[model samples]
Target: MAARPVSGAGAIRVGIGGWTFEPWRGTFYPDKWPHKRELEYASRQLTAIEVNGTYYSGFKPETFAGWAKVAPDDFVFALKASRFCTNRKVLADAGESIARFTGQGIVELGDKLGPILWQFMATKKFDAVDFAAFLKLLPASQDGVRLRHAVQVRHESFAVPEFVALCRDAGVAIVYAQSDDYPAIADISGDLVYARLETAVEDEPAGYSPVELDRWADAARVWAAGGQPDGLASVSDPAPVMPRDTFVFMISGAKVRNPAAAQALIARL
Candidate 1:
């Protein structure tokens, strides 16, 4: 987030959910800047972004390629898996939907591609057998690129050892979504860590309070170094010293100022 160099393979990426919000034009971007150049501009400012468009609607291969061409080499874009795949009534029945979504040209992003987020609705209670079957559906690669998956389960039923073990065994990270509306499970289930901070307020200049941003930065560093933060809710016990790359996103809540919040957190890192 702060443009800091990552030693070895471990890195810390800080960013917002998306780059096309109109409210960011005057605040996060130049008021007179062309809308078409928003991605290019935002890529320069934030280390990463969670591409939310793919969740609502699919994009063409050329569209993904176009995005890759505009951003910096180090910039990463985490794609949110299609809602059609995760919003279904039967989690185990998502194979075809999942395959269709993954086959929809996401590999065109190449090196710019980060983790793919699979967010389930809050009402989708955790069913160990069904959830395990769904986890098995996630592929490890697309074309020649290795794929990373992060699951954001909103139901309170997901806070359990069985859920954590399923994710850990599958090597899928469990998204550490920070907000009052969702269950807070900060378990480190895979090789990478993902966090979505949604507490940014409208009036707060940087979205979150300065102290809060500082705390987030601290926690991010710990995760990047392959350690979990103390005091946060966690379901798994990560090895005491194994380090991993981490991604932290400032999303939702005070959406208008999310970019600013990311920049603020980046500054601390």
Candidate 2:
């Protein structure tokens, strides 16, 4: 469970959506292992974790500090921005909510903080002007610690070139979601790559076939090196080649097998 070494210019981290799950009690965690130490065990097995709970509830500064203390030095926690920020009827008016969420002592995570994911509902359509305004609300740093942001748009309207241009101009990553339900935008808009792989199957021991795992591993390398992988859908031209840190999380589809899937992908990397 030691930190996995990275050899390239940009690091590629693979992980699951969150650390806590009742199904993982025996399958992922050692049988009868202390429930309180789940994050400690999970942090060592994977390089990152997308904190889904933060999307619904806020945590105290001490809670964030506690997480940072338990996690490994190289481990990262990608926070899902609160629902109040992205689920509003008018995204332009979310400044107060955004401020509230960012000001909630997230900086306590320190180096353990990764990207903040702003996810919109599928019903939310793309409004170039309004969306641009929302992106502007995202701060470059919080409490002297630099912050990275990524947006996950589920509507197909977001797959247009203008959307990609907006994110590119703001330097916010457009999460490359690999799923049949969401529009997969593979364009690289920022210096970092954030991906959520949602195609895991319950039948597969690793949640994905070995072939699929290999494919994702290859794609991760390509993304880390700042090159587009072959066959992914894109609305914009290829981005200039430059190294970028990559974060890939196994989420949704077969939730039970996600930890295994994340570990498998990490091994392949």
Candidate 3:
């Protein structure tokens, strides 16, 4: 629950989910303006954050670098691949876009780019054949690339052994989400974990709820205490999972109320 860097022998493996703005609003001023102050605040405790805005366009490299400069050498940043890539399922074109993000956006952030998250929508179901084909298309397979690769699926239909095997075989970390599709949590297990919180109740999807963020933060803590080579059952079991070193990303900013979501999770921590 402490806002500190969660490190292991390999990657720094920390949360890149930065959805809040106020706490960092003044932190990063007119000087570094949004860059230095932002990173300085983030690096104060949290190790990494998900680049939520990159999914949209108009990203600049210099800004990323300013953030990298502020953060310490060991600090890490998880860069989310654009929606054109993950949401649209344009794996082929996604490669080029991803390359651009890495070469441009990431380079600016420098060494802070910790992992590359390929998050998909819940409306998208799992087509094992299509997905398997898509996974094979990543320009550089998980092994070939230096960055960690993780996938988040919204539909429970995708929670099949074949899919899990495919992700495991591909070295992709499958997400264990806390939405209505909540799949036993035992079903999804891998080296890395990406967790998102959506807490907007004023108005939202048919059954959307923002209050769940509190429960999730508690659950994330339980799941983030272990490392890899850790079997599915072991990671799923609450016994070991309770106090494991697993890295559950604190992703937010899915909407305007994301600030509310971030505050909720941060409060729990």
In terms of TM-score, the best-performing candidate is: 2
**TM-score for each candidate, following the candidate numbering:** 0.96, 0.97, 0.64
The digit string of per-residue lDDT tens for model 1 on 215-267 reads 98889888887777887987666644566778999999999989999988888
Q: Which has the higher lDDT value, candidate number 1 or candidate number 2?
A: 2
Model 1 backbone overlap count: 2
Error of model 3, residue 215, in angstroms: 8.9
Q: Which is the better candidate, 1 or 2, if ranked by TM-score?
A: 2
Native-to-model Cα distance after best TM-score fit, residue 102 in candidate 1, in Å: 1.1
Q: How much lDDT does each candidate structure score?
A: 0.89, 0.91, 0.54
Q: What's the lDDT for residue 152 in model 1?
A: 97
